[model samples]
Target: MNVIIWNCRGASKPSFKKRVRELVQNHNPAILVVMETRVGGDRAREITNLLPFDEAIHTDATSYAGGLWVLWNADRVDITLLSSTEHEIHAKVKVRFTNVSWLLSAVYASPRNAERQILWKNLMNVAELHNLPWVIAGDFNEPLLSEDKFGGRSVSVNRSLLFKECLDKCKMLDFGFAGPRFTWTNRREVQALI
Candidate 1:
């Protein structure tokens, strides 16, 4: 089943909602993970209205810093919310047609480099604890290679290596991506950003 994981940055913007709707229409994902929402309360409800998912679980923002929304098509998949935190949402998803279950971890990794290592350690612990077939995805904030960076400054090799080591230690494979080479584009013409 197709699952779409996105770090939306914020959902309050009309443009973001429109883009999300387009993505939903295009991909028709069985499960959807939206991270860094930066909005809550009525705006969250408004964001949900624009999507096709029947059921949703939300983690509210902490002072405009982070938020999470996990949406799933109830008719297609049965989802059990196992656990959640400011950085991750763990769930067990069973596809009704296949009668198969797997663990899904939706992560919004801390942008802070130091904190990211801790996040990786926690995720590794989860991996060790749960032997279930797992598919973990989100905006990890660390690119694995030079090619992974589209237009940004040279990525930190140490950060990339740490991420790679964690994945290797956990025996997880990169599912890779399709469509856009860069998930983000800095169109603002900012010098330091690029």
Candidate 2:
């Protein structure tokens, strides 16, 4: 099944919506996982209607920036919101094509190492309980390898190590960081020859 995960930063912008629409038209993934929606209340509903998918699970409550949202083609998949935490969201569903159960998690890890460790532990517990083939995707905010970053130290080596440990514990595989190598860019131009 085709799945698209993006950190839209926020879907409130006109340009962002237009770009997302373009992506939908081109990719038409069976499931769409978005992070940092930065949307709330009626605005979230407005954004959901634009997509082909009829069902969505958005952040019920949050303590930080943009919450998570998962939209899927209702007819093709059955989704149930298992649970959600302050920093992570979890959903359990069965993909019709494979007749296999899967769990999809959208996570926005805290930048702080201590908080991130806690998040990692919580995720492991969730994964263990579900006991299904799963895919967790979002702005993990940490890259496993040095290749994931451009220049300078990537920061959070210990945190990145923890992320890797969680993935390994859950027996999950990285989808190979498809699309753009760098999802964010600074306004100031700094040329680097790699």
Candidate 3:
């Protein structure tokens, strides 16, 4: 099934809403996974209503960072919110078209290497327990390889290795980076600084 994952930075911009609409019309994904939504409860509800999706789940906005939301086209998918933590959300659902069951986890990793390692470990544990076809998608905040970056920066050998190991151990594929080579930019307008 088609799925879209984006870290919108925040949902405050009119551009963000316009882009979401465009994505829905153009991609028509069964599921839309959004990160850094920067909205909670009422605002989240308002935003979800504007989208074509029938249901949405988001964490408490009071949390340190704005939370995640999974918007699903109810006609094409049956979504059961399995669990949610401060940094991730887990769901168990079947893709309507293929009838493929998936243990889907959408995550936004901490920028710090140490915290990310811990998060990855925890995520891997959950995946191992389920033993179902799984997809983990979000702003990992760490490039998998030197090639993933625009210019040569010292790729964190240990962190990169751990990320790869976690995915391999969990049997989840990276799916290859799509759209822009870099998903984030700095205020300076310098490209590929992430």
Candidate 4:
């Protein structure tokens, strides 16, 4: 079973539904985690209903920023909500017709260093609560290494240090990426990856 996690920036855009539909059609993921929705309330509900997923849970956007939506196909997988904060959604997923069961934490970490520290701590608490095989994925908003970033101020070892410590304590390792060394860029003349 495949899970697709996307930081879509904003879900209120005119093409949001079309883009999501295409992703669903192309990838056919059992679960789709959307971060940074920047929308909530009635509008969020409307959008979720339009999507192809059979079930969904949304962490509403605060003001104009930060929202997370976890959608899944009920026929393909059964998902049980574990807990959630503005920064993450923790759940247990069981694939249909199988004995497989695991924890999935979809994160949308804050850009602020302090807030992200809280996220790390919360994740550690969650880890201690369950021994099931776990998959944690999303936009951490903090690069874990100097090499994970390019073009801009040098990475702050202090921040990366905390992140690394959290990973070590949680016994989690970066899955890394293919295709591009950097998944994000500033898009200006002075481009940086994170």
Candidate achieving the largest TM-score: 4
Q: Candidate 2 vs candidate 4: which has greater TM-score? A: 4
- Candidate 3 or 4, higher lDDT? 4
Local distance difference test scores for all models: 0.83, 0.76, 0.79, 0.89
Which regions in candidate 3 have their CA more than 4 angstroms from the true location?
Answer: 61-66, 151-153, 189-194
lDDT of 4 by residue, 104-185 (tens): 9999998888999999999889878889999999888888878777877889999999998889888998887767666567
The sequence of per-residue lDDT tens digits that candidate 3 reaches over residues 16-54 is: 889988998898888999988777778888888887888
- 2 against 3, candidate with superior TM-score: 3
Model 2: which residue pairs collide? none
lDDT of 4: 0.89
Local error of candidate 1 at residue 33 (angstroms): 1.3
Estimate the TM-score of every prediction: 0.85, 0.85, 0.86, 0.93
The lDDT, on a scale of 0 to 1, for candidate 1 is 0.83
Q: Between which residue pairs do clashes occur in model 4?
A: none
RMSD of each: 2.5, 2.8, 2.6, 1.7
Instruction: Put down candidate 1 lDDT per residue, 54-114, tens digits, no spaces.
Output: 8887877778978888899999999999987777888999998896999988888777888
Give the lDDT ranking, best first: 4, 1, 3, 2
**Span of ten consecutive residues with least summed lDDT in model 3:** 185-194
Q: Give lDDT: candidate 3, residue 109.
A: 75
